[model samples]
Every structure is written in structure tokens, then in C-alpha cells.
Target: MSQISVVFHSGYGHTKKVAQSIAQGATAQLIEIDNDGEISEQDWETLNQSDAIIFGSPTYMGGPSWQFKKFTDATSKIWYNRGWQDKLFGGFSVSASLNGDKQVTLILLQTLASQHGGLWVSLGQLPSSSTAATRNDYNSLGGSVGVLVQVPSDADADAIPSGDLKTAEAYGKRMLDIVNRFKK
Candidate 1:
């Protein structure tokens, strides 16, 4: 089986919950960037050995968390040697506002993967028509590049919307499928 890794940081439990769902659906390994914006040597090695990488972070100030940015900076060596060249890449993000500029966060991830010479994977899920969509509908927030999850500012992480979790899981599975197909 192709090995995949989900590298991410969660400021609150909400992002962590979504990441867990993604990992479960992908059957992928997890390498979390710590609060101090550092990853272990083992995490680095794991990322280097992965067949695919799915990035994730909570959107902060219209961008990815600083911790995830730190991890990206740490990947410069891998980028230099083309260690991740042509590998499949995907990303996901969560935020408090309905329009939290979450797209910016995904763009950052896509850029990082591109700099590594990785092949980008779109979410591959059709968005619900806003006219007909419900709050719990898949891709309700209409993200095509990556999964976007919105958790109310005051809501507990455990109370995240089911649709968002489902979207994340589906994105994970799609990423895995793309990785396996290209591995042939």
C-alpha cells in the first residue's frame, strides 16, 4: 500500500478533530507540528518517506497557522533535493468565520507543495448549489481546492458540523485514491 502522511497543526480541538477524520479516511500517518512550531526529526523522516502528503492547519489572520508555516520552512531541504517531487498533495483547513479567508490557507499549502515539485490534488467533490444547499450539505462552504470547515467561535470542537467532518473524510479518501493511481 502506498504510504501517506497528514502533516498539520491544531490551535484548538476543532482542527484536530477534522484532521483525525481526514487521517481515518486516508489511513494515513499523522505528523503534528507542535505548539512551539517545531517538528521532531522522526516527523521529518516520516514526511520524507511518505508517498503523499495532506497538509492542514487552522486559518489564522487569513493564512495558515505559524506552526504549519514553520514546518513548511523546515521542508526547504526536501524541496532542494526534490525529495517530494511528483508526489500527490492535498490540504484542508478550519476556521471560525463562515468566510474566514480559509482559501488563503489552502493556497499557502498548495504553494508549499508546488515548491516541493509535488502534484496537486483538488477536492474532486461537487459543491452543493447554494440555492438548494443546507447547513449540513457536503461542500456547503464551496471550496474546490480543499476542504473548508467552519466551527462557531464559541462552539466546542466536539460540536463541529457533521457535514464538515464528512467533507474532510471524503477529501482524504480522494487524495489516497489519487496517490494509489499514480503509484502504478
Candidate 2:
């Protein structure tokens, strides 16, 4: 089976939700960027073997967490060798505020994928674009691109609404479809 790996850092579990959703849609492995800035060597091997890589992180201070940044920096060795060249790449990010400059985070991720000579995929679904659309709408554009999730800073993990989770699952399924088609 073709492989896909999602490497991510989650400060408050919101991004983790996104990662889980992506994994559910594909036969992919999930690697968490640890607090100490490490991914297992086994995961590195998995990455090397995979046909696609997806990045996820919480938008912190207008960008990704320092842990995720450090992980990205460590990829310099791979970058030098173009180890990830020709691979499919994609990303998703979550933030507390609705307008938390999440696009900046996504750009940073896309740029890194580009540096590795990878193809980037955006969230394939369209925004709801209607006044009657409610928070429960499938494609509500509350700053989510491809599985964009939003959680109030004060809300506990249990308080995360079901709509966000469903959206994330749909995004993951969509990504799987895209990767499968691209490979063909």
C-alpha cells in the first residue's frame, strides 16, 4: 500500500484532532513532534518510504509552534539530498481565535514542502458561502482550509464541538482521494 505520514505538534489537542481525522481516511501513520523536538528514527524511515507527507501544527504567535519549527529545521539534511523530491505534501493548522493568522502558518508549511521539491495540496472542499449556513455546515470557512479546526482558548477538549471533528474527518477522506488520484 502507498504510504502517507502526518507529522504534527499540538499545544492544546486541537491539532491532534486534525491529525487523527487525516489518519482515519488513509492508511497513514501519525508522528507527533514531541516537546523535545524529536520524531522516532522509525518514523524517519517511514517518511522516506511514504508517497506523501502531511504537516499539522497549532498556530502559535502567528506561526507554528517552536517544536514544529525545530523539526522542520532538522529536515535540512533531507533537503540537501532532495530526499523528499516529487512527493505529495499537504498541511492543516488549528488556532484559538477565529482570525489567528492561520494562513501564515499554512504558508510556512507549504514553503517547506516546496523546498523539498514536493507538490502541495490545498483543502479540496469549497466554503459554504451562504448566509443560511450554520456552524454545523460541512464547509463552513471559520479559517479552516483543508480541515481547519477552531477551539476557544478557554474551552476544554471535551467542549470541542462535533462539527469540527466531522469536518476534519471529511478533510482527511478528501486528502486520501487526492493522493490516490495523483499517484495514478
Candidate with maximal lDDT: 1
The TM-score leader among the candidates is: 1
lDDT by residue for model 1 over 23-106, one digit each (tens)? 988999988888998988888888888999999999999999988888888888888998999888999999999889999999
- Ten contiguous residues with the weakest lDDT in model 2: 138-147
lDDT of each: 0.89, 0.81
TM-score of 1: 0.96
How many residue pairs clash per model?
0, 1
Clashing pairs in 2: 144-148
Candidate 2 lDDT tens digits, 1-184? 5688889998877788778877887667899989887899998888898888999999999999999999999999999999999898888888887768788899999999999999887777767668887667765655444556677898766655566667667766766777788878
In candidate 2 the C-alpha lDDT for residue 8 amounts to 95
Clashes of 1: 0
Candidate 2 regions with alpha-carbon error over 4 angstroms: 142-145
Runs off by more than 4 Å, candidate 1: none
